[model samples]
Target: MSNPYAPPDPASRPPKQREHTGPDAPSPADGGPGPGKAPGRQGRAGRPERPKPTPEQLASVSRSVLHFGLFMLAAVLTMQVDLPWHLMSLAFAIGAVVVGVRALVRVFKEQIRGGIVVLLVFGLMLSGMLVVTTLGSLAVWNEQMERQECLRSAITVSAQDRCERIYQEAIEDRFGTIPGG
Candidate 1:
């Protein structure tokens, strides 16, 4: 007795044939492989169609890169100068903000890694700006303190003490304090 689920012998069935009558029909005239299966299908159901990046994405990426480079250049110029011309530092700060914002826009446009780099760099630059600005203010206040010595000699004790307190507070504001002192 034969099993009910036994496979049919090849001799008992006709040869298989390709059908070209439906939506999955092959374009044989274009030299494709055959019906239903194309040569490009490497695995299950072919790769999903991905939307290409828009021109806006490309522009944002380029804009952010340019502004980030500008920020770096401005940072070097500001840090190495003899005089504390804060204009350059301010420009660097502005550049950092611009680059970071542009990068954020790009992040929504499928450029995650690039956007993150821009944001991190901007954060570093802003932190450096805080330190540098504080140092510059300290220098300016120190000069005023030196110039005000003539007033200290002429003023009342109370006025002199007030002036001294102002200088002390300025120093503390710039550099918090030594560990113990």
Candidate 2:
């Protein structure tokens, strides 16, 4: 017995019956145009021809994709917890926003349909991240600067220790101790 899940053998099957019998019905031999398809719609392989995208649409899509990648990179960078890297993350977020806006504008002007939703969503998300990072960076700015200056002038390990102590004190003073401690 044949396996129930296996495909049927084409050679043993009867020929397909055409649904339409009129004179205008598509010919099976030549794979003539089907219903709703005009003769001119077929391309080289009898498939419908698709319209090519314009250069503007290509640019818009590329920019939108780039912004998405940049935004993700910024989010990862922000988690590094280093001041310089946080600044770099801020820069990446800013660049993402700029690229996203350009993509949105191009998509709107050219009437491209593909990347508008991506641009809008990532643009808003990147903006919120940018503001949050900027504020966080500002809050730590003075402490970081003082620590850096202190460490820069230190010729010995003890002075560097002093800089770290000051930074810790400033942070604890501003943020208070851990709840359980």
Candidate 3:
């Protein structure tokens, strides 16, 4: 009666232990073999490989924030100063153009599909901002210009009135009577 699960020849069983004698294997001083170099020399060997953000990635984030912030700040400040809104809006548009170009360059350099999508979206947003700022500034400038024109007209009318009174007085003195209109 033999057990079904038993080995056919128990006397022929292989040895349980195997010896490691490779140069890559860990020395006795550093415990058994493992991934990477020995513990004490790990620091001197430089840091282990790690995933890190590339320069393009860092530039992408930094530039995006900077352009956006600059646009907003310019928009707000334009309202407080007496400078022409058209000029402020033009500056904003130029800034957006610069950001768009930078984004395009980064997309090409990084060659990342996701990054490209993000940059494109940002470009669209910046473009829209440019348009809005430009239009808004134009409107403000037109309004201010109209007001200035109105003030100039008023000043001209007043100056004409004063000149007419002086001319009447000079004519009366020359003729020894009031000048008739």
Best-matching candidate per TM-score: 2
Cα misplacement distance, residue 35 of candidate 3 (Å): 21
| lDDT values, one for every candidate | 0.60, 0.70, 0.58
Query: Which model scores highest in lDDT?
Result: 2
TM-score of 1: 0.41
Q: After superposition, how far is residue 82 of candidate 1 from its true place, in Å?
A: 3.0
Question: What lDDT score goes with residue 100 in model 1?
Answer: 62
User: In model 1, which regions exceed 4 Å deviation?
Assistant: 1-50, 54-56, 111-177
Model 2 residue 82 CA deviation (Å) reads: 12
Which clashing pairs does model 1 show?
none
> RMSD of model 1, in Å?
15.5
Q: Write the per-residue lDDT of candidate 3 for residues 72-129, one digit (tens) a residue.
A: 4565456454436446656665676666666666655555456556756666576567
RMSD, candidate 2, Å: 12.2
TM-score of 2: 0.44
Over 19-65, each residue of candidate 1 has an lDDT whose tens digit, in order, gives 55566644655444455653544333444334556777767676776
RMSD of each: 15.5, 12.2, 19.7
